[model samples]
Target: MAERPRTLYDKIWDDHLVHEQEDGACLIYIDRHLVHEVTSPQAFEGLRVSGRKVRSPERTLAVVDHNVPTTDRSKPIEDPESKAQVEQLAINAAEFGVEYYNEHDARQGVVHIVGPEQGFTLPGSTIVCGDSHTSTHGAFGALAHGIGTSEVEHVLATQTLIQKKAANMLVRVDGRLAEGATAKDIILAIIGEIGTAGGTGHVIEYAGEAIRDLSIEGRMTVCNMSIEGGARAGLVAPDEKTYAYLRGRPKAPQGEMFDAACRYWDSLRSDEGAHYDRIITLDAASLPPTLTWGTSPEDVAPITGAVPTPDSVANPAKRAAIARALDYMGLKGGEKLTDIAIDRVFIGSCTNGRIEDLRAAAAMIAGKKVSERVNAMVVPGSGLVKAQAEAEGLDKIFLAAGFEWREPGCSMCLAMNPDRLAPGERCASTSNRNFEGRQGYKGRTHLVSPAMAAAAAIAGHFVDVRSWR
Candidate 1:
């Protein structure tokens, strides 16, 4: 008999597994629990009603992001409901004695962005948040996912979650990405190929040359969108690049501890010949700058492609979905994507609001002015990212090009605050989703890369950046 080979997910799961139950479920310890305003209020209320204290308050971190206005943070929040939610989170954090980052805190930002920036997200850790995009932390080889409010309360009281293991999925992207293609393009292409439900009930491990070659920020962008592809979570194996990014971070381990942690992280990869329930391979070089033409993220095509005709699809369900999406997006079959004009351009979100993303957009629109008819804005992912961008003069480049440089806080990504699309308005956005009414009621969205969005802002239409350049 021989020991069975294991995947990166298996290794991390085993390390954190506290107990196995007869019902085929296991109790896994959570190393980090990141909370935000939108999801934590109810959970805290549950704790108050039950007379329970957080089991490991020190392990949990709280921030106000969702529903917080991205503009003029210094003033009172305008929306009453939004203000209440933000205020309640601050009160709850104070009551629980948990670490909190409010709008005024220098460390304040989206939980996903703040976690990695603060080094609270480390390799081989089990992280949970009330956010679906908590999978973003998986970029460091961690096992992370979103949980419901009840599950949030459970984790808060017990510091562990009971769950069944997800099936293993390997997504390999070999070959170098094309010059104009980015990690956003690569993930969008993967979703487009597999459809939104392709990785359902699975934990996806993104590997191969293309993934390995991406910068840590790029890897984060890919893993951040795994949920959109219907994966339980997504991860990249920790390596030198992961270590370099973690080194010298505020909460990261110190010298000798970091070295030891690296040793463990080195063993976090899948063993050679390990079995996966399913596998997908992509040729990275063949991918173009992808954009969603319909409602779903999978309803995407290259910038040079056109809207797909539902009539051309053979499957009734898929055809119906395509038709419905096309109706919602106000698109007709066979219309060239480049010919579709946009009313606005938004280049910020958890998906693409980091400094690298800002730089990428700035480089594309450096000397080009935005179309007068198009309202374009650039929002950074976090206050830190904002300060960094300003230091590098990226803000000036964007302002000079007619793009409004605004504050950070998931702006226009969900339209929770004032940043939203007017009814019937169409936008080229860097956000992950393109669901109907995602940006606003009856608003149409076309998801694209930061550079593609910037290019669209300038051209006032969807043009292939490869050609625009």
Candidate 2:
């Protein structure tokens, strides 16, 4: 009898397995450990208490992002708590001998953005971080996920983590995407189809022609939001696009080593007839630029659609959830999204703050000015991204269009620093989450594509970018 074929997740998991314990947990080697200011303080403290040094400091990389201010970064961080967190991360990294990127470093940015840009995240590697968006690295065919402070300590102390194998899930998107549709829309549509908890207990492998056609940056955008759908991690099988993006990256292998690495990465895909615990397919051509009308990412609809009525839902629990979300968002049932006005617009985050995203928004709003009623801002994901955007005059485009072009940081994405929405303010945001008070206390968030957010900034209301185009 022949053995069954294995999935990409299974292959990667097996390759990294250090030891399988009787409790069904395995010790897996970590190839990369990305750290951010907000979550590593406790783990560093743990190492201090136990009198243990980092087992492999070379494998760990730290950056100050979450707690850094996007405004006047040269000035002292105004928020005392945030300043303390950033300072602590620097102290910890120095004491641990781990490479640290401070706010002043040109490479410094969001941990997820900096990792890929610097080639620290590689294909067929096992990566872990204390941040939930660590799944963003899986776009390069790596197995990565967010862990707690305890797990962070374990990885730091031993360069390994104990974990149970996650069930496999395949999310295949077929056909070509529509003109105005983007990777953001595709993922939003999937979340809408499956709901917020759809991928719980699973690692999603995105496959099919549509996914294969997306640019490496676009693929990252899709994988970055997998956590929003409750997936432990998300992955994409790497190909030429992935190799092209990694080829000259700062940490990528050179010459013969690069060729050898590619050969191995090429083989890191699901075998024919591999079994998945679940499979879902979506038609890409039918998907429109989508937006989240309620508090959850799963509460999505086409840009032209209206807010859903709670009474329309059949599930009692879900109906109540919709009701609560509607009340919190200050939305009325059957309200057309286009009729809703926005007080502000935010275009940045790990999900869509890459150079490609900046270019898209810049092209959309080049000649048009932001609505007089709207306060719009653009924050790059990293210092590298910021420099590249300026080189292309994207910052000038944004500023000319009345959009404030700010420094790089995870600005207004989770409101960790001074950038945040006021209470009762509604925004058209290009970030991932839209949970209640995510942008600020009582701030309502409408998740959108970069182009859509740009259009909203100009129109002061939600409008279909396809029509604008």
Candidate 3:
């Protein structure tokens, strides 16, 4: 019999399967487990109460990011709850014998960023974290996703998880991207086309000329938002870009071992005739700088467009939802996107906080002052990213441009840290979500690429970045 053709997700899933139940649930072995301060405390406590030892301490890595302050790390964490979460992760990592990166450690950063930076995420492996952005690891061709706290404890005790296989979906973007458009725009466009429930039961595998052209960092940005699209996870097949990114990392295989690893990674792509449950094709060249207008990631439109009217939507429920979102966003129907002035701008997150993202934003705003009406800041994804940005003078450019160059952490991405928006403040942000109060109490977020955010910061309003001079 001929060998069965399989997708990247299928191949990885089968390789990790330990058992299959009649109800369609499967026992899958998790090769990598990433823990962080926010979700691991209760998991560790659970282990302590039950007296269960971590099955594979060496395979797990812990870091502090979500609740860490972005200013003056020397001072103690000001938020009592944040301080407790950070301190508890340290105690848990030590007690469980897991490798840890504390706030003072240079390697410490967002869990997703730290994983790929250290090469702990690899092709053809199952990776899980207690954070939704764990899908970021799938960019390297790993089967990765977020799990609840209970599942986190389960994985710690057994190094395995119970899951039902998700359908395979293909999102292919062909042709060259227009100038000023980026991986962030591509993803935003996808969610806009498919809506939030589009990938609810699927594992989306991104492939095509546009996806292939993206650097590993770009791919990471795309996969990082997979959760916002309502997908189980998203991935890109491992190729030269993936191997090159992993070649010399601290935890990646060395020299001859790396060569052998590359050979295996080469076979991690979907077979030529593999079947997909669904497929979505896009013309990358047609995609413009995209942005989210409403609270949901699905509420997106191109930069050249105007705010949509709720009356334009036929569905009453959807129309009401759009009305509510518009009211909250302080936007009126039919207003030009560029007419929407912003009070703040934030350029950083697991989605766009990489070095490349910083460089792009810096280049766009170099020698230009931020709008006097706008308060803007840039936060690097990791401590290492922060160091690299400073070494290349990216920090100088941002500081000179009137943007705050923050210390590394998940600052402004969510309300877990001090970096946040004031009530009713409208911001052009590069972070993933723009949900109500995601940044702060009643804060309004409009998701855009780093370059677009930088442009908006300078203009004090949304501008078509492609035409910005």
Candidate 4:
């Protein structure tokens, strides 16, 4: 008989599966179902059309972050498209009996942030969301991933998904990251080297030295971008760092149950001499603080690096893509990233709007003022994150530095929130995604780490922030 396999993804996927399909797919039970405004409308409509109730209402959690206004929530949305989306989500949740964190609720924010903060994202379970960033919850040791609309319907009807096993890929980073580098930089460099789709059809198991030293928020950021690399999911092996973060979380077990949970989490690591379908090793010493130069996160370079010229590229396809990015961004090839000025700097999103991220931004800009030319905002990711930052005086620091510190919501990341850039406004932002017109029509976005964003606000360009430290 073959020895049993115990990969982390396998362990969780096998444990929660209620049945196996004829096509080798597993009907895996969903432990947490996070829903936001954009994708839930048709889902709820589907439920109504078929007279199907939510399979497990308690497991299905809803929040209105994407389409709600960030600062002004006094009345209904003025934008016709935005107004209809929010109203539909409310109606859907009410009819289905699923818990809805409305715009006025304290729990309202990005689905990923709300899910973890509410203590619903426990370890040793499966979580699915209609949003791709659902991999953020994998930092808690849960096997989480995004689902399509069809899978969303499946969860509503049966609270399960028919999923095939993803090949396991181990990414081992051996060495502590130097000061000024973050998990963001590490993942950015990895994607830069591996290309965007390097992890297709695989579950990335982040391991080795550098990743172990990352904070939980940092790990969440790293895993949050898993989909950017075309990976099904990304995870860190559970450890002291993971436990310390989850210990006081509302949903984590307490006392003996907690102790037992930790023991099981410890056992989640790859066994001695375990094999992976693929292995990619990273040297932490070689990395530098970086930013994306093109639409894709994979199109990145060092903070001070220059844009690549099309003629400098040998491949015509590559040349065209780079050329298009430069045109849309109003940038030129071989120009220094520092020379690129911006009209705004935004610090908030599911990617970098947590308490720790706020502190990091505050640390960078404390006793300094934002550039007069730069309009900046700091929107928290959750009500809990907002309250915690306020208690710590982080909000005071942000406002003192000329940042408009607003309430929690998705904000400018996905433009599902009211906060968005105007046409032709270039921005240095901590949110992910720099696709053409992502923030607004013809609005250009340059993605960076939170600390880098604060530094850019102070300097009015993509300046290296390590000097401040």
Candidate 5:
């Protein structure tokens, strides 16, 4: 008799199963748990009510990010909502004995960014954060996901997650991406091709030459949106790049432990004959710095593509989505994507908030100042990235080019940080999500690669950077 073959997703999940509940769900161990201000308060309070302690406080890490102002994080936050969330996180971390990385910790950023920087995420582990982009940790070859507030509460009480096994979906992007086509572009293009709802009930594993060549941050950018692709999680096989990225991080293994861990990580790659339930391939040469002309990331088109005419949409459900996206974006169908002017330029987020992203934007903006009509800013993902960029003079290049060189944090990514668009202003953003009012009241967002955002900052419109490059 032949035994059922196990896909990589199943292998990882089965390795972590702590117990199976009566309802047919398995409670799996979470090797690393990352927490942010907005979601942890209620969960910690739930523990207080139940008189339960964190199942493993050492495995948990906390940060004050979503609710803190990025521009002036050194001072007390003014918004009562923001202050309460940030302060409550301080209290909760203290009560529960979880290590808290506060606003000026030099390690703070988006919780997703901080987790990897802290080396808490490792290969072959299962990680969970209360935030959706927890999938970002999958870049390190982990089975990770964002859970609900209640699930966060449950994990804190039990150190395990009740989850259903997901099918495996292999997404292989082959060949070399041309110079200006970045990780952000590759992801936006994939979402545009697969639609926003394509990978439901599945776990995605990225492969192929282009994906293999991406830096840790670039890999993180793609994996960060596996959820946006409707996948439960995403994984990239551990390789030299993954090992190199984790080499000297705070919590990563050291000396003998590091070498031994590498041996285990070496075994985490998909087998030569590994099986996946579904597979999709993309040509890297086909990508360019892209943008979402409408609403969802799936509403994206290469900067060269026109705003889709609703009547021309092929899918009935997608046609309605196209129409709604156009309406919310204040654009008419069949409009030229290039003619959609931009009022602001944002170049940072967990999605595109690393030194390489800043370097790409700087490379495009050097000797070219931002258009007078466009207000632009660059926010680094962490104090570390900010410092590294400054040492390379990228900050001066941006400031001299007329863009504001802001502090380190998730500025303007979600309007939770001090940076934001003025009412009714339109922006070309490197951040994820193009939801109406995502940046502020009535502010419109068009997600783009950092290089594209830089080109738009100078052109003051959504112009394709492949041409500019």
Candidate 6:
């Protein structure tokens, strides 16, 4: 006789369910589809071979990011493979009649960034891309995650995804964050506690006072790394801040329509009595400026801590993994994190390339020079973010601080483009993932927040950002 209580994930899931099978597989409509160069070529080709037109061309948007050069766009792309992928995306987009933003378009950026910037990612929508970081869109209370190339083709042809429901997990962070601690630190801290497989088969909904306090951009940073934590997706309930962030964007509903949308978004939260499959809580104030000393996101320690020894892990397999990671990272057991030097600093990716990230890094490096021993660069998440940073003079501050101001793209986040590390070159990176060869062949990556990456650029090693002047 009573309405059933449901989690945010359940609410969105039920809203999008089109058909359910006996084994629990469902056909769920995809509201927003973000496309990039690397993964969609095959999907697009599948459509061509089958003579399948995109069911909802207007709902799909494509852009070039992963394979675009972060350097001079005035010149033609030099790498043959990169050139082909970029060109093919343009061709595919034209043939399919899907809206596209090319390398030179002002709207061009990492698909994850462009989606939210243009208001294409909306609360209560089901968004998908072929890239792992598609989880980033969940920041707006959407049910979003990455899909495979086959799934991409399926969505392009049908505007629906085959899916199974994921259990709901809650990651609640209480108390205010410490000074110099950021949303990046919060997420890295979470991965440290949960390990890589912690959120397997679940969707994590981040709640509590600390999560509420984060700006939408910060929330995006957290959700962007949900893949690193093994979560199917991550979500935060829509609130006034979420509504405010979407209000003036181009694709968002405007004026009275926006007011009506807000009314629906307001109910996007979990009911008071909803249950979670698992719950994890953290004391935000206790989190320090954290960094990953090994190859995995979970191999994290506070900046003030030391590299963990293999023996510190009780499980033999985990201990062996720790040893392998430390060896790959060029870190010795018990070495202080601050004592490890870095040769490069990368301050961009879908993870930490927003305008706010740029502003934070710029504020930290203002009137200060990057260490002569370290080569550093800043790549904005999108061309729009680049323009915004320049408008606010953040670009000048970074240039004056001796950090290269790179064009927008997924620069140095992976080895896809020209921005990469030489073998054995250690880097302090703001991007997500530090897996073997993530940045380049045998490159060593230490993941940090934008400010911490900037600080490392200046100090040439990890430092307690909380103590930075």
What's the C-alpha lDDT at position 41 in model 3? 89
lDDT of 3 by residue, 41-60 (tens): 89999999999999999899
Clashes of 4: 1
TM-score result, candidate 5: 0.96
After superposing candidate 2 on the true structure, give the runs of residues whose Cα lies further than 4 Å from its correct spot: 1-3
Q: Which run of 10 residues does model 1 get worst, by summed lDDT?
A: 65-74
Alpha-carbon local distance difference test for all models: 0.92, 0.94, 0.95, 0.85, 0.87, 0.95
- The TM-scores, one per candidate, come to 0.99, 0.99, 0.99, 0.96, 0.96, 0.99
Per-residue lDDT for 162-280 in model 2, tens only? Answer: 99999999999999999999999999999999888999999999999999999988999999999999999999998999999999898889888999999999999899999999999
In model 6, which runs have C-alpha deviations exceeding 4 angstroms? Answer: none
What is the descending lDDT order? 6, 3, 2, 1, 5, 4
What is candidate 4's lDDT per residue for 171-196, written digit by digit as tens? Answer: 88889887788878888887887788
What TM-score does prediction 1 earn?
0.99
Deviation of model 5 at 389, angstroms: 1.2
Residue 56 of model 1 has an lDDT of 97
Tens digits of per-residue lDDT, candidate 5, 1-469, equal 9656666677788789988878778879888889888888899999999899998999999987777776665688888988999899999999999999888787877788888887899998899999888999999999999999999999888888889778889999999998678888888888888878888988999999999999999999999988888988989988999989899898998888999999988878676667888899999997876888876778787777788888996899978987887777788888888998889999988898888999999998899989988999998888788888999999999999999887666678787756787787899999888887788877899998888899999988888777785
Per-residue lDDT of 243-317 in model 6, one digit per residue for the tens?
999999999999999999999999999999899999999999999999999889998999899999999989999
TM-score, cand. 4: 0.96
List, in order, the clash count of every candidate structure: 0, 0, 0, 1, 0, 0
lDDT of 1 by residue, 1-469 (tens): 9979999999999999999989879999999999998888999999999999999998999998878887787789999998999999999999999999999887787788899999999999999999899989999999999998889999999999999999999999999999899999999999998888998999999999999999988999999999999999999999999999999898899999999999988999999999999999999989999999998899888988889999988999999998998888888889999999999999988899999999999989988999988999998898999999999999999999999998878879997888999988999999999888899999999999999999999999998989777
lDDT of 5 at 314: 83
lDDT of 3: 0.95
Instruction: RMSD for all candidates, in order, please.
Output: 0.9, 0.9, 0.7, 1.6, 1.6, 0.7
lDDT, candidate 6, at 440: 99
> Model 6 clash tally?
0
- The regions of model 4 sitting more than 4 angstroms off are none
